[model samples]
Target chain A: MLNIENIDVNYGAIRALVQVSLEVNEGEIVALIGANGAGKSTTLRSISGLVKPQSGKIIFEGKEIHNFPPHKVVEIGISQVPEGRRVFPLMTVLENLELGAFSRKDRAGIKEDINNIFLRFPRLEERKQQPAGTLSGGEQQMLAIGRALMSRPKLLLMDEPSMGLAPMLVQEIFNIVKEINQTGTTILLVEQNARMALSIANRAYVLETGSLAMSGSAKELAENEEVQKAYLGH
Target chain B: MLSNFFVQLMNGIALGSTYALIALGYTMVYGIILLINFAHGEIFMSGAFVGLILVTVFHVHIIIAFLGAMLFCMIMGVIIEKIAYKPLRRSTRLAALISAIGVSIFLSNLANLIFGANPTSYPPTKEILFPVKSFELFAGAQVTNLQILIIATSAILMIILQYFIKNTRIGKAMRATSQDYDTAALMGINVNKIISYTFAIGSSLAAAGGVLVGIYFGVVKYNMGTLVGLKAFTAAVLGGIGSIPGAMFGGIALGIGEMFAVAIGLSSYRDAIAFGILIIVLLVKPTGLFGTEIQKKV
Candidate 1:
């Protein structure tokens, strides 16, 4: 459904990604796993148009989007839940979700989607009037996902959704990710939590430094000795 | 003496309403894009002259002139944002600020060339609207029709603005944009469009204030915005740089404070007092009363 080919990205003097290529087919949850500064977040950022690639192409369902601005990228049905759950700190939860659908004009459908989000995350329904900044880390993560889902995206890019949650909350979040995938939204997930990511992801790629080091079926990569030693800490 | 005090207090309210109106333009633009928009004061000055032109040359009613000035400045604000602020969005904050100051100087000079640097009085209010009259609120406490008109119109405009920001979808997008620019774009909001809209709304309010100032003070000048603009900006900072309510409160407080100073025969130091309040506010609460502290994400 999405293809990134030989993309290079830089931040001034620092090369953030070098020759990074990856793909996600329809109805798949693809995980990009790596350590800090391993180009995982940069790859997702490049696809979402937050960071433009110096070279290579990003084709989403066939059309190139590497050069599109971030707002236009979302208009083409791509939504990103950025790292650290950057929800609008001063906006109420409902306002945050309403902004999620800023590019869309279907008021009734937008309202319906918001209700569905509330149903999925009942705590959000209870705290709809509260400022998002007041939410706990776990709840803020939920709000971030729920906000992205408000756009009715064809492809969702989730960056480190499990970064700072309790173990049980992390499990709950992974379960929710699987549930979202089952509902027909293709996902490109970047994570440092390899075990939980591999458990849910259909396929996985391991990135080292600024380059892709390995790719395979999720099970095989999980069982691979090198991935196990380096990522899984076994 | 006490009646004189009451009359002066009423005058302060009318004057402060104008300050609050202009201060909102500063605060809103600052909240969204973090630009001080030094040119904003020029926008106010331009509004007064535009109203004057419409009233004198076109022979329009005072109300029509007021609305015309607002519409003119609304477009002016958008044009200014696109030309001056948009190109510098990705550049350093200082670059945009310098560009803003440049625009301010250019606008004021342009106005001077057109209006000839002379202070022009508005048409007599009794001739245009109603008889120049005053209501006796109490012993020596009187409010003129003009003062009442200015205060009421400003209050109505402010309420409408408040409603628009609180209840509308675009308003929600605005708040989101102000909170986090990147995250707002990620939600598919055209951040540029929101910025332009913000400029339009704020400029309209400032223009309205400009017209009211002309009516209340009976005089308008090319460089009028220089001092009023600074006062409005001070009001914004005093209230908390980005807080809407803070701007409102700060303007009134400053207005009343200035009136009290004048009452105590310290009128010459009124400007100094305003800046003194700003310094003290910054020293005590640098964020302004309502300014939110930006959180650094890990």
Candidate 2:
């Protein structure tokens, strides 16, 4: 489980996130939905240690990790599939995946996990030697997810896993996210696609501007009049 | 005339190998951090001085001195980076560049203070190391043992460097970091450490080039890095600033071009010819020969 308490993040003169808080229970998919500049990605980045919170604390399984650097955050079992699927363009898919487990030392375990990832995504195996940049948008998204999974993370933070994908591919990526959560890893997903995100999430939080606007069970949030009109395009 | 041309070609290669070595440092550091590291030349100068001291004062073996110079410069490069460039990481590129120039001036002046303005010559190769002997290559063309040694050693070092970059885990991490620094950190790569390793490797290569240059030319001076550093920087840019293979090709090509300039009775314009090529490359193909086209992230 993870807990974020009243975290504030700013980018110079702009307050990207203000007093925002969220949590993810073990073995659950938690969705944070917001529009552009709604601080969703900022929230994920703060938790991943890419950006520092000006105030408050982030407790992952009871330890405050707000000040840890990005690499240290990954070392502590939190891996992020960054926004826009920033895979290394020049590196082969296999190399990208290998670097995902950069902090791990278990050679045998790493190898086995890579094989397992290949099994789960056969397209990846077929193009393992190809550079990740050359992959299709959908495939790059898959590679990004696969790369994050390589860290063997306890908490996987995904930022816009479905951005810029075909509708069908978006469905496939969300299905993969659901499948991944079913296998025991906790996921904190940030998405502008509220409908799809709410469909798969166990709990959901809606962010407006830089603060939490609403929070409830995924079903309640999906069916709520305000949530539907504002986020679900109902 | 043909034999003379062949001999010049060999000499050019020996000279170019040193340029390639130094150019690698420029290209690698720029690839990772996008900093030109103007102080890189000073690092080369320091490496030559270190090698000179090891050989003369400490009386170490030539091989040991070579390795020691590399080690010393490796540390020196990292230190310079930490002191001069690292603090300016978040600042403008101009800031870091200015910092680099400052380090360069400080280093060259420090060397001037210690070694004085006089150019120090290495002991005669016959007395301290091995006898210089010329061996015929083919068709009346002759190559010296020193030339062969320089070419062989540079080739070996380059091969090892290529292998290290292409095959090793740290090397892969380095490539990834160069491609995407923040994303690399998301994968748990300590990018700071990677940058340090880059500085170390690049500095070592520059050191090797420095020592080889000193041995070949038999003289090391405080300001030797100025013109040579600019030339190596030219080589890096000419080869494509961030491209590894391009740096090698550019260095050798520039070297041969200079030798040819000399061969054609334009020795005074040799430096001019090198810079002219750089300007032409910049105007014609700014990315250099092997540079990747910049992509807009969607």
Candidate 3:
């Protein structure tokens, strides 16, 4: 339920995104796959209002949101789990989750949701009072996802959640992402891990440099010769 | 002689509590935004004037006047942040620092123009809080009821502030903002509002310190904040610039150290002694006692 149309973004002299366009329909896990500097994160950042585009519009559920700030974007049911997890380093795990629902006013629902999250991430529950920075890589990734879920966003834009994790933890995170989609939350996942991302995504787009290079069903893209050569390393 | 020494210690505590009150403002603002808020001392100075106007001009009760001064300074602090500091937030740290110094100069001059450069003495304490009374300890050492009032009130306010920072939802938001500004905004925390709230709380504490100092020392001057503000800043840095507990400890330590210096026949070097202690402490621990070493990610 989100449409980004021909948005151009720049960082002074460097062009980060050049007329980039993409879309995510409701209940679909849309994966944006690219290499190190292929503008995947930039696209997500523009949608989240962290980076304002120079042209074109970002339509979320039919309203243009290109002018909104990061907080306003969250208020409208779009939450972003930023690159590097970015959890409050000094705060307890529970407090991090509490801040995730900062825009909500339902006290009882917040308490219940926190409990639900604790059940889902039992390791976090065990260290509920511990500072988030002390969490291991895998656990911090879980905390980041859990924190995003706390906001109850209809659309969760996650950037590089699988980065810096062990291979086993990466598999676990991919499984959790699929499970989250099964529960009906639309996801816009930006990742360099194309193989795992394509395996779980309903639809996928390949970004080369700053523009969309290919788009198709996950299965078709996974089998495409050029995609296999460039992204999947087959 | 020993009892007289204890008497000086008590007086030092009374004075130190006032410094601690002002230092809290410094530490909290620095913790969140990393700006020194040099104008804060002027906020404290304005607090005394606010108390003076309420007491002398409006004839309000001392308790009400104290609260009034705090409320007035809280608003002033927020306004100063909105006007002076907020615009410079996105600029370099140097720009914000320069803006702070400018605000400090502007505020002090404004106060000087309004109240004149002369020092104004507070009304007699006997007419304000109950009749002034004294208690005698061993060796003819004495403590006034007003001294007890200042010390007890400061303690209670500090406890309340500690509770606020530790337990409240807004406080949690503040902690989050201080840790990561963008992440807090992504979580839908209005970071600007949190910053304003910080200024309000810090300014109010400084105002409370100002009123206490006005009553304790029996005089308020346009530039009273200069030395006291510097010492409070030294205290904040000495205790660990951004740590709440560190600010409290730093203020009290600096106050007691100054008094003890005076006691040991070093009264001529009183101000120099405060900075000297700060320099030595900082040299030993560059981050101050509570400041965490900045962790660099490769």
lDDT (10s digit) by residue, model 3, range B1-298:
8777877888888888888899999999998898988988989999999998999999999889999999999999999999998888878889999998998999889989998989998998877777778788667888888889999999999999989888889999998887787788889888899999999999999999999998988899999988889889888988888888988888888888888888899999999988887788778986788788645332
lDDT of 1 by residue, A123-224 (tens): 999999999999999999999999999889999999999998999999999999999999999999999999999999999999998999999999999999
Ranking by lDDT: 2, 1, 3
Top candidate (DockQ): 2
Error of 2 at B104 (Å): 0.6
lDDT of model 3 at residue B272?
A: 100
Highest lDDT: give the candidate number.
2
Instruction: Considering only chain B, report the TM-score of model 1.
Output: 0.97
TM-score of each: 0.97, 0.98, 0.95
Per residue, candidate 2 scores C-alpha lDDT tens digits across B144-183 of: 9998998898889999989999999889988988888888
Listed for each candidate, the true contacts retained, as a fraction, are 0.91, 0.98, 0.89
For all predictions in the order shown, the interface RMSD in Å is: 0.8, 0.7, 0.8
Ranking by TM-score: 2, 1, 3
Q: Say which docking band candidate 2 falls in.
A: high
What residue pairs clash in candidate 3, if any at all? none
Write down the worst ten-residue block by lDDT for model 2 chain B. Answer: B289-298
- Candidate 1 DockQ, CA atoms: 0.88
